[model samples]
Target: MSLAPRAVLVHRTTEYEELLARHGTAGQAAFFLTSRGRDLEPVAARHARARRTLAAVEAAVPLHWRRARVERADLDRFLFGPEDVVVVVGADGLVANTAKYLTGQPVVGVDPEPGRGLGVLVRHRPADTARLLTAAVRPDAAFDELTMVEAVADDTQRIRALNEIYLGAPGHQTARYRLATATRPDPAAPEESQASSGVLVGTGTGATGWLRSLWRERSGPPALPAPTDPRLLWFVREAWPSPTTNTTLVQGALTNGDHLRLVVESDRLVAFGDGVETDALELTWGQTIRVGLADLRLRLLV
Candidate 1:
């Protein structure tokens, strides 16, 4: 028989700890919060609850499987194998953060604070860890296969996103990139190009996120990606109409097997997945980035 897959618990630092780390002392942090009309009690309470939830989750793990805990900041250093299941012990954003590094592994999102909105990805409470983990490892497990987006650069540097992939400058300055896209579902369609501020390629799971805000601004937002839709939505931000640049190809959808390509006409451009800027791919002039639906899907346990 095969060994039980390891359950990797992922979490991040709480607001309380971040404040203390910045202020160097609890007393100093409290004083700083008071000056800003914020109290430390609420933050402390939330952090305490998170701790309890983590304890319960770890204790609930079965003995046959190896258990490991990792902080969100340390995810890049941690090694995950095919026989491992990832458990995110935070809000939906944490799930998005954890999904980029994953390759078709089952992910269980635990809402540490049940009172707050759990978001679609995190469907279970901390108390549900044991049962969820057990179901996740089974062959007959029922899961929502969430779509993911990918960006590959000329240098071969690649990244994936469960929510969205942002391509822009570090400081939000004017980003100059010549964009061309081939709508995969319609191969006979000719590719087009444009110069713009930046590009945003998102999945169906990201419809309600940053992409949603952009969608709301337009009289008609292209139908947002559905949770199981094997397609990606692409939008160019503030496409500048210049004598040298065409603004006609500002928005489109990239179906599965199709890709959107961008040539960095500017000196520099950066690509980050799911809002994690630290983990990014940097490109220079003449570099090409291809965006499309990723081969791996996030199997989120409901």
Candidate 2:
């Protein structure tokens, strides 16, 4: 007998669960929400709906196929094999976070909510679980390959990101770094040492996320990449001009063969991808880091 294909269901704690955890008691949670003029009914309803969705997914799964459930908090420690089919039952961010850890697994993004913004990634509803699962593990499953970004440090450490990678101080304080790029328009220009809030390197799939906010905040926003575009966009936040620091290399696009390098001029800097700080790369002064498009692509089941 052959082993059945495994399906991994990824989810996060519901709002009600979070409230109770924070308050330590149902009464306290209710009191806290009431104080904010919110009712617990909405949270309860959402939790109930999520449970129903999970149950439906469990029922839809074939007996021959192995099924596993993972919480968002444990995603970093979870081990995923290449043969597994990933199903995320959460918001859009959860899908992005899950994508980073996967190399070639087909991901089915399930939106717990029915008619909201129609999540860009989590487009499927809970009701479609059975049908999507059946198609996901098929040899000819229709999927879209989304681009991902990567950050490589001088210490030979590397992190891949499906959404965007953030490089800077742990807090909101200014980050001082020497920014250099292989694709700089002015080849003669020396590497620039600059002080800024931070830098964001993201792929086309991430354009609608953190990159979009940065684009919108600009005086003249540039066109961003589509979900499957094989390009990357990077920008420095609040680059400060000083006698020693320059801000000329604040924003640019990176193609397949291009790379962006940065030397940690500050005391400390950190690089995190998909907003998962637990899985972060730490950089001290005198360290150089490179950010670019990763060769691996996220195969998202559309």
Candidate 3:
């Protein structure tokens, strides 16, 4: 028989908690904030609200259902089961941060501070958890299959993100690579060698974030995709033109089966997702990587 579905509560360390940890005392934390021309009351209040909201969500879980709690820092090491019902109790970015580690688990995004957030992903309040949890396990439960992006290295190392995947140097230096795409209609077009900051591939959901800033600067066709659109958008950040390297293939759109291929020309290149640089795939010279739409979609409960 199948085991009962687990309610996995995901959260991040609050700023107040971090301050207290750093200062070793609440009074010292407040003093440090005061010295910086900021008040501690607001931070403490937000922390209190977060704790209350987390408690409420935990209390709402069905007593008999298996439950687990994980912090954002520990997500990389945490094991998520197939039958897990993930509940992210923080900002919308927290949901994005947690998305990559999960497979097809249904996620319920709960806004701890409702009015302050954009409410795009974290649409529900703490009180809605119990009802949402019940609906999430049903056969006809409604969910939005948010598209995600992935980068796969030739050695089988890979990473996925709900927002975007960044492949480039780990620092402020330029990254050198040969770029090509398999989806281009023009078969005669040749691949280009590039030396620049890096390459970024993002989904429609990501268009509102990093991709939006880049999209706004350029005026052209192939509009950004919708949140659920299967298409992806890619851009080469500050591609440097040289005698040998060209910037002809800077930006484009990708379809379902399309992928962007890159052969590393530098000593090292890193591929990371959702701005988490710590957990990334490292590539050496001559190693190839492909960026494309991932098979894993984020099953976000609406």
Candidate 4:
């Protein structure tokens, strides 16, 4: 488990070949899969090729089959269960499936086409498939009993190693939310105030994203706000703001301390991490939505 991942991009021959070259048939491995929304032909073909290649790899691990692997139980296997990595190739749907199935999780969303997948792509990161699932068995997400301040074991590495975290509309509303934060950080009393139209959580890992969005309203390269580590939170809002189910967590003394509420007296509001909607929770005014920094820190292959 102390090595690179068993790379699983989308369903592709080239992707498999590429990842295979990086980490050969090793300890434990798998092909965690999701529908490409395309004919299974391509995926089947890639599976054949991957299977054949995997057959030849001496260090390869047994490949297990988890039918309809995107649901909660199956996804639990995807996230915390021990095995090695299950590579996800090209398309983002499968990548998204993985994220949707987990919580307080950091998923590196990779978009092959920037124009088509700007929002989701920015969230994906290359991961160590082998390491993530090793004895994961739904490990304790809280880091209260850690031997060190930094995580020596699994500690929200999903988000921390990836460094950046994303917030987006929970549904297809295209709705945006207001942002607010304390001028000074007060964890004990985070919900004391609210301000601004756009809410962004900028971390030390995602500087450019929070800052650049401020410049062009909504324009930037695919790789801005990339975080080296998780620290700091940026709050942003859109100009000529349209309604969105999104809410930004204020960094300072206010919102972080307690229940952050999104008022939905008239219209409904959706909330989610990054852009996936399964966990995209609907909200009502005076209703409490949870938000906070998780203790688990990711250890990247880098």
For model 4, give the 10-residue run with minimal summed lDDT: 144-153
Minimal lDDT window, size 10, model 3? 181-190
Candidate 4 on 249-287: residue-level lDDT in tens?
433311223222232322444444442345334553443
| TM-score-sorted candidate list, best first | 3, 1, 2, 4
lDDT digits (tens) for residues 60-141 of candidate 2: 7777888899998898789998778999988888888887778788899988886765588888987788899899887899
Question: Where does candidate 1 stray beyond 4 Å?
Answer: 185-193
Residue 60, model 4: lDDT of 27
The TM-score between candidate 1 and the true structure equals 0.95
Candidate 3: deviation at residue 53, Å?
A: 0.2
* TM-score, one value per model: 0.95, 0.94, 0.97, 0.42
RMSD of 4: 12.3
> Comparing 3 and 4 by lDDT, which wins?
3
Off by over 4 Å in 4: 1-59, 62-79, 82-198, 202-226, 239-267
* Number of residue pairs clashing in candidate 2, backbone atoms closer than 3 angstroms, sequence gap of 3 or more or interchain: 0
Structure candidate 3, residue pairs in collision = none
Clashes of each: 1, 0, 0, 55
Q: Report the C-alpha displacement of residue 39, candidate 3, in angstroms.
A: 0.9
Please tell me which predicted candidate would have the highest TM-score against the true structure: 3
Model 3 stretches with alpha carbons more than 4 Å out: 182-189
Model 1 lDDT tens row, 136-156: 988899999999999998799
The number of the candidate with the highest lDDT is 3
